[model samples]
Target: MKKLLILVFLTLPMIAFAQTKPYLSIADAERITAAAEAKAKAEGWNVVIAILDDGGHLISLKRMDGVQIGSIDVAQAKAKSAVYFKRSTKIFEDVMKGEGGSRIATLPNAVGVEGGLPIFKDGIIVGSIGISGVTSAQDGIIAEAGVKGY
Candidate 1:
């Protein structure tokens, strides 16, 4: 029993350390935003991009000139939904189009829109990015570019 207790105590810290998740850094967030911005600029689209950490905390936000002011909140909501739900916002948008999908609207902070994607590192979600201001499909394209940057 003494040996077993010592082993358990010795391994506890390793277990805790192994469970620590990777997080999005400020530099990574900035890189993602820059990539998304480049895509938007190349396509001549004015948009708002929002990046969130694994905990759904805002890391970065960019609203291009001529983008609607309302898109700021929408972009953040999309990013938050992606991080909190661990999936693309497009899934919710698609579900909302189906019958009985109105229930999705009841979920707090859920945005039924495209352009939100969970950023992955080594198959684990590290963060998310959301874009707004252009068409949903276009926003999705920009978001994809941002995630690819990371």
Candidate 2:
């Protein structure tokens, strides 16, 4: 029993690691960014795009020609929020503004806003993409454009 317990403890981390998959790669992030940039240019909608890894770290970002400089930070925050929270930023935005707004906002790394959309690969959410410099609806559209290839 003692030997079995020791073996189980030793292999638990490995087992947990195997359950999760790395669905988003650097190439995917770049490609998604490129697609988003192209769509923005074609539509004449300048914006800032931010892509985050599954762990909510920055993967890629693009500031378009005419986008306001402030959008970059907002874009990153939105992406981080989605990736870290594992849900849509829009949902958090609404929940945070509700009766328990303050309590909801206090969650670590939680961001309550729009413009963040999870990037799913093979039905698994591996990362998220965020777009700024336009209305939330437009941000959703831009992010969705990038997600199509995935």
Candidate 3:
């Protein structure tokens, strides 16, 4: 029993260290925002773009000319949901399309929208991006362009 306890204690630190997540640099955030904005413009979709670090803190935001004011908060919320949940908002939206779909709506901080995506580098999620002021599919496309910046 003493040996087992010692082994458990030794592994606890490893477990904690493994939980560490990467953060997005300011330059990277800027690149992502630019890419998202470019895609929105290329498609002629006026949109708001938001980027958030892995901890769900906003890093950068862009509001294209003519975008609705309400899209600013919605874009940030979608980015937060992506980073906080460590998955694309599309996944949550898909889950809501089938049986028991309503259960996903109960999850705290889960936006379940289609415009958010996690940004990954070296197979680790470093941040996320979200776009709004367009159709969900178009917003998702723009967000994907932003994620590719990393």
Between candidates 1 and 3, the lDDT winner: 1
Flag regions of model 3 displaced more than 4 Å: 1-21
lDDT of 3: 0.89
After superposition, which runs of candidate 1 have C-alpha atoms over 4 Å from their true positions? 1-19
In order of appearance, the predictions have TM-scores of: 0.86, 0.77, 0.83
Order by TM-score, highest first: 1, 3, 2
lDDT per prediction?
0.93, 0.84, 0.89
> Looking at model 3, which ten-residue stretch has the lowest summed lDDT?
15-24
The CA lDDT at 4 in model 1 is 100
Residue 86, candidate 3: Cα error in Å is 0.9
Clashing pairs in 1: none
lDDT, model 2, position 21: 67
Question: Which of the two candidates, 1 or 3, achieves a greater TM-score against the reference?
Answer: 1
State, as a TM-score between 0 and 1, how close model 3 is to the true structure: 0.83
Of the pair 2 and 3, which is ahead by lDDT?
A: 3
